[model samples]
Target: MLTKRIVPCLDVNDGRVVKGIQFVELRDAGDPVELAKVYDEQGADELVFLDISASHEGRKTMVEVVQHVAAELAIPFTVGGGINSVEDMKAILRAGADKVSLNTAAVLRPELVREGADYFGSQCIVVAIDAKYDEETNGWKVYTHGGRKLKDLDAVEWAKEVEALGAGEILLTSMDSDGEKKGFNLALTKAVSEAVTIPVIASGGAGNAVHFKDVFTEGKADAALAASIFHYKETSVEEVKSYLRKEEVHVR
Candidate 1:
């Protein structure tokens, strides 16, 4: 079986790492570069840096911040937020991200996905989907602009669409569950994972080690990403990996 990846996400704003519940009420986490080094040292499988406010502010990701964070890690890094074109992707990649995740930009112009995959390889392209459950839709709806805008797109269908458009992976974050820390939204994770063949990195609502196991086993996620837990020293990456190993979930 493929080893499930445990990723630490740095939700950065103005070059500082921050975390918030349901995508609001942001709190200071730490310096992005410092947090990146700590997670890398703790054996994180990968690191994701998101300039959470960039898209909403109409700008590109902080390349300087990305470069600093990238310098601290030996593991793969993914960057997202405010990437609007192939040139933007190039800049982020040049700054040292192993992959560039497109959220708002991709939704606005989905052909950008193919454009990026064609310029880089599919492996370098990840589409991030922020989803919130909608009883009116009878499923989850896609959110954009740092989870401030809701789109008509259905979360599961968007996953398949992006996969077909040549995105290498999906970063699925549940806005409803984001930062709640009770547990991941397993049902939503499972739905998106099963809908697409590409790897899915389930995000939001990761509370503890057992939450990781449940997401891997029942949610069928290829990897899981969390922020506040690791950011605040609530749990270390090594501890989570140890717990996963005990539960027979493969980890790297």
Candidate 2:
């Protein structure tokens, strides 16, 4: 059985790690390079570094930052934010990212998903979606540029489309649960996980080990990602893995 992954996310802005609620009201956490090294040594299955303001700021990802963080870790690393073209993806990959995650760029041009999969293979392409419930539509709506822009895209349908386009994985983040430290949006996670054949990573709203287990066993996610919880020493990756082992969920 494949072990469920526990990943620590570093949300970067202006060269510093930050956290926010529902993708707003940012709070500085620490340095990305230092945090990445700590998470790597703490037994994190993977590390995700997202330049939260890159797209909104109209700049490519922070290559120097990515390089600094990558140099500190031995585990697989994934980078996202402002990845609009194959060249951008290539740059990050060359900088030591095992995978490149696409958000605003992928939604803006769905063809990029297919093109990325063709160029780097599906396993290297991850589609990151930030979604929130729309009271007017009574369905989940996709948000872009770090949940700053609300798009007309339907979250559920977009998941299927990206999978069909050869995306290897889906990093589904719940805008409603993000930074709340309540729990994962299991309903949304399960919906997307069930709808796709590829692996789905549940992000946002992980308060404890239970939330991690819920995402893996109940939400059926292949991985669970958290920022504040891990960043603030609220929970450790090893503890979560130990708890999952007791729960009989395969974990590394």
Candidate 3:
């Protein structure tokens, strides 16, 4: 089996890392640059730095912040939030990001996904989907604008479309599970992962190493990402890897 990836996410609001439950009640975590360095040292396979408020606040991602964080990382870095055009993508990549993740922008204009892939190759484009279960829809619906606005799109279908649109990977975040620290939404993760040929990185609700193992095996996720647990030092990346290794899960 292919090695599974354990990633730590740094959600930035006004340039400071923060974590919240179900996308609200935000609490400060730490400085993004310092957190990035710590995760890199902890044997994280990759890191994600999100300008969590950029889209909602109507501004661009802090390029300087991304540059600073990227400078401290040897692992691959993905930057997202407020990227709306090819120029935006180019700016982030030039700032030293290995991949650019799109959520609101990609949903607003899916052509941007293809445009990004055409210009930078599919390997560099990751489409993030913020999904929450809707009883009205009887399925998960994609949310945008940092989980503030709802889109009339099914999560699974959106995942498939983005893959066809040339997204290299899908960063699937469950709004209902965001910062729950219970476990990943296995049903949602598995559904999206199976719907696309691209790698799926399951986000939100990661509580422990067993949670990571479950997401990889039962949820069929190629990668599992967490924020609060890692940020608060509830667990370390190396510790999780150690547990996964003992459980016979492939890891780097």
Candidate 4:
């Protein structure tokens, strides 16, 4: 069986790790390099470093910060935010990110997805979809610019398109559940997971270990990511893995 992964996300803004509710009202978590080392020591399967304000600020990802964090981590690392082109991906990769995630840029120019996959192989490219539940359309709508802009795109359809365009994985974040700490959006996660062949990393609303079990089993996410819970010591990676193991959910 493939073991489910537990990833701790570092939402960086102004060089400090931060977390917020529904993508606003940010609170400082800690230093990214320090947090990465802690997570690595705690046996986190992987770590995600997102310069949350890069895209909105119209700048590239913090290559130096990424390098610093990557240097401290022994496990796989994924970097996102303001990664706009193949050149951007190359720079981050050269700086030591195992993968580069694209959000607003991918929405604006999807050709970058194919171009990135071609240049660095699909495994190095991750397309992040920030989605909000739209009651009027009765579907999930894709958002970009850190959930500030809504695109006329369906989340599931976009997931399929990204996979076809050579994206190796999808990082699906539910804008509705973000920082709510209730649980993940199981319906949204399952829909996107079933719609695409590649792996799906479910983000948002993970408050406890049971939530990870639910996403891995019912939500069908290959991995579950959380920020505040882990950052604040509300839960530990080992505790989560132990809980999942007891629940008969395969985990690493």
Candidate 5:
């Protein structure tokens, strides 16, 4: 069995790490490089650095910051935000990012997903979908521009499309559960996971180890990502992994 991964998410803005609830009211977490070193030491299987404001600010991901953080980690690192072209992906990858995650750019021009995967190999391409439940539609609606704009796309359908476009993984974030600390959106996670063959990394609403366990077993997530909980020291990566181990969930 493949051991599940525990990933610490560093939502960076202006070179500093930050986290916010439902994509608003940001709070400073720490410096990205410092935080990445800490998580890497804590046995985190992977690290995700999202330049949360890069897209909204109309700029590419901070290459200097990505390089600094990547230099400190021994584990796989994924970077996202403001990556609109294959050249951007190459720059980040050359800077040491193991994977490049595309969000708004991928939605606006899906061929970018295929182009990126083709140029860098599918293993290096990750398509992130930020979604919220739409009660009227009876399905999750995809959101963009830092989760401020709701697209006409359905989350599950988009996940399938990105997979067919050659993305290696899908980082699914439930805007509804983001920063709520209740738990992951198991329904959303499982829906996308089942719709695509690529590995799904569940993002948003992870308050404790049990939540991780639930997402893995019920949500069918290959990995679970947490921000506030891990950033604030409310929960450590090892504790979550240990809890999952007790629950008979395969974890590294």
Candidate 6:
């Protein structure tokens, strides 16, 4: 059985980790390098460092910050935000990112995904879709630039498309559930997981251990990611995994 992964995200803005509701009203969380070390010591399966504002600010990812965070951790690290081209991917990888997650960049130039996959292999290409429920469409719509821009792309279709383009995984974050601590968006996660063959990491709305269980068992996500809950010392990764183990969910 493949063990489910528990990942903690560091949403960095202006060099500090921040958390917000529905991708707005940001609040400070902690230092990315410190948080990365904490999560690594806590046995987190992977650490995701997202420079949440870089894409919106029209800047490149913080290579120095990536190097700092990566140097502190002994686990896999994924760096994202403002990754626009093959050169950007190489830079992040060279700076010590185990994987590169593409959001707005991939949406604007989808060829980046194919090119990244060809150059770095599928395992290094991660397509992260930030989505929110659309009232008009009555389904999740993909958003970019930290959920500030609404695109006409369908979440499910995008999931399939990225996988077809050689993306090794999909990081699906629910704008509605983000920073709410209610729970994961199970329906949205299930839909995306079913739409793609590669692993899906469910992001947003994880308040408790049960939320992790729900996402892995009910949402069918291969991994579950949260920020504030773990950052604020609300829940520990060990506790989450212990509960999942009792629920017969495979977790590392």
lDDT of each: 0.88, 0.85, 0.87, 0.88, 0.88, 0.86
Kindly report which residue stretches of model 3 are placed more than 4 angstroms away from their true locations once superposed. Answer: 19-29, 53-61
Give the range where candidate 2 is weakest over 10 consecutive residues by summed lDDT. 20-29
Q: In model 1, what lDDT does residue 183 have? A: 90
What is the TM-score (0 to 1) of candidate 3? 0.90
Q: What's the CA error at residue 51 for candidate 6, in Å?
A: 1.1
Please list the residue runs of candidate 5 whose C-alpha ends up more than 4 Å from where it truly belongs after superposition: 19-29, 53-61
lDDT of 6 at 247: 94
Better of 4 and 6 by TM-score: 4
For candidate 5, write residues 50-132 as lDDT tens digits: 87664543234367787887777778999988888998898889999999999999999999999998899999999999999
lDDT of 1 by residue, 8-28 (tens): 887777766666322222242
- The superposed Cα distance between candidate 1 and the true structure at residue 212, in angstroms, equals 0.5
Q: What local lDDT score does residue 118 receive in model 1, on the 0 to 100 scale?
A: 91
- Please give, for residues 1-252, the per-residue lDDT of candidate 4 as tens digits: 889999998878766676632222223235677667677777799989887664534234377777787777679989898888788888889988899999999999999999999999999999999999999989999998889998999999999999999999999999999989999999999999999999999999999999999999999999999988987788888899999999999877
Q: Weakest 10 consecutive residues, lDDT, candidate 1?
A: 20-29
TM-score of each: 0.91, 0.89, 0.90, 0.91, 0.92, 0.89
> Cα lDDT of model 1 overall?
0.88
What lDDT tens digits, residue by residue, belong to model 3 across residues 1-252?
Answer: 689999888777776776642222223235677767777888999988787664533234467777887777678989887789999899889888899999999999999999999999999999999999999877999999889998999999999999999999999999998878889999999999888899999999988999999999999999998888876778889999999999999999
List model 6 lDDT by residue over 16-112, tens digit each. 6766422221232356776676677778999888876645342343777788877877789898887888998998898889999999999998989
Per-residue lDDT, model 5, residue 247, is 92
Model 6 misplaced stretches (Cα beyond 4 Å): 19-30, 53-61
